[model samples]
Target: MTSALPDVARHEASDIALALDWVGMRGIAIPLVLGGPEAAPAAATAELAVDLPDPHAKGIHMSRLYRLLGAFAQHGKLSPGSLQRLLREMMESHTDCGSRAARIGLEFHLLQQRPALRTPGLAGWKSYPVSVQAMHRDGITQVELAVRIQYSSTCPCSAALSRQAVRNAFAEHFGDAPGITRGDALDWISGHASLATPHSQRSEAEIRIRLSPAADTLPLLAMIDCAEMALATPVQTAVKRADEQAFAQLNGANLMYVEDAARRLRQALEQHFGACSVAVSHHESLHPHDAVASCATPGWKRMG
Candidate 1:
């Protein structure tokens, strides 16, 4: 025997996020694929996120998102098309529930390679943290990409002070060498300058950019190279004695302040992404606080 029950029943619904703008899960770890240095694909761990609108909807079907992600993991290629498709699926999941908008965030560690300084072989596995965020509303989608690169920055002030100290020592010790040859003078200067103290700073550049829909490809590794060049010194993975010496010389040659680091990144972004907005932050070792700067697309307000 079957009991008579209505298919639909009236129930009270509560607005949980009346005062809040967004609420969701974060740092959810999952396996993902990213474009390799040579356009091949590599596996990485991805942190995923989704925004929930109505708190009283009981809870989001988290399993559905996971299954959708599995589909990408199984067969999707790591490219602009795949990324956009993932975003589209996430938005559709939310839109089916009568929500107006949805947001998804993914973070992964990408691998790259570097040629050995003294050897002919290539070394692998320089990991960089990358993030991608997608927001959808009313048939429009916006995607943002972020990458963090590790590099070295020598202190300009400290280098200048070291030079001054060396110059003073030379004037005091070698005042009698008036007829010294240029090479001999250089040797004398190097002997005295070797005693000066050099300050080395460990720094990181964090860059965020809005992607062009037409140029859907994500140039994360290229962007990383731009940041490394801007800072003038990037930490190396595989190093020989020569490489170490060269790296030391690089630090000595290109000393910079945190402001200089930010400006360098800004210039690089402007050169690479002409119409894209860029936000750069330099984490400095010499200071207690991080230095940050931002440059926007010329007509961001108009676009908004």
Candidate 2:
């Protein structure tokens, strides 16, 4: 039985956007399976984006992207290989629409274990939000990964001031008692000064790279570890008295301003990802501002 409705014509494009470089959706949410550093797969909420390179085109077929995501949701693992496949799928979808380039951004929360300082067996999961981005053009692909870690930083200037305050306090309290032990002087100093101001800065480490199609899928855990080590003090989940003391000692040893944090991350990324570009941002507490630093290799020059 034929219906009376007329057939709609298929939309076609000859010349799409000659003026615009990129156009697409952002903040699309989807479920994802992330693998690595776990006995089983971890479920994560992914914020995904795909670049559609034209305005003259009728519209992006958004359903295709969702279908690709669904295929991955069923059995896909989040590894370098899986990510490459996902990018290829996205590019293929866009190619059907005549796009010469494709880009994708995905954000997810990753979990890692935190070992107790003194207790060897006590450990728990800690969450770190991460992002991965990929771009394809003319058979070339580039990838970037980013992670956010929380850490404590003591202001060196503040630490020095606090030290002087303590010395003065000992002099005033003990009345020039030369017999006072160094430990006793430190105790008196801490009592007189703001011994520890919480310098909780949400820090970020981002690395972008141009990769060979055969390049190994990055070890996400390795990247996370490098960033944490660069920052020096990551917040812990299962902490005891010993852990707290260790954390305090770390803070004291690694006194950093926002600039120092960014530089350290940049150096660490350079050491770890030699062919990649790196950027670090430290959300500062002392001011209503953020401190950011970036370094890039020749391979990742386009990132700037």
Question: Pick by lDDT: which candidate is best?
Answer: 2
**Tens digits of per-residue lDDT for model 2, 1-304:** 3366542212655354543355556676666666545434545544334555555565566667777877877777655567667768876777645666666667777777778767789998888777777766677766766666677667788778777766565567899567778898677656665543445455555655443444445457777778788777877778888988997888888988767876777677778776665666667777798777777665455631
> After superposition, which runs of candidate 2 have C-alpha atoms over 4 Å from their true positions?
1-9, 12-25, 35-56, 93-96, 174-216, 275-304
TM-score of 1: 0.79
| Local distance difference test, each candidate | 0.65, 0.66
Per-residue error (Å), model 2, residue 295 = 4.3
Write the residue-wise lDDT of candidate 1 on 80-113 in tens digits. Answer: 5566677668656655334555556677777777
lDDT of model 2, residue 286: 70
Q: Number of clashes in model 2? A: 1
Which pairs of residues collide in model 2?
166-189
Q: In candidate 2, where is summed lDDT lowest over 10 consecutive residues? A: 1-10
Clashing pairs in 1: none
Worst 10 residues of 1 by lDDT: 6-15
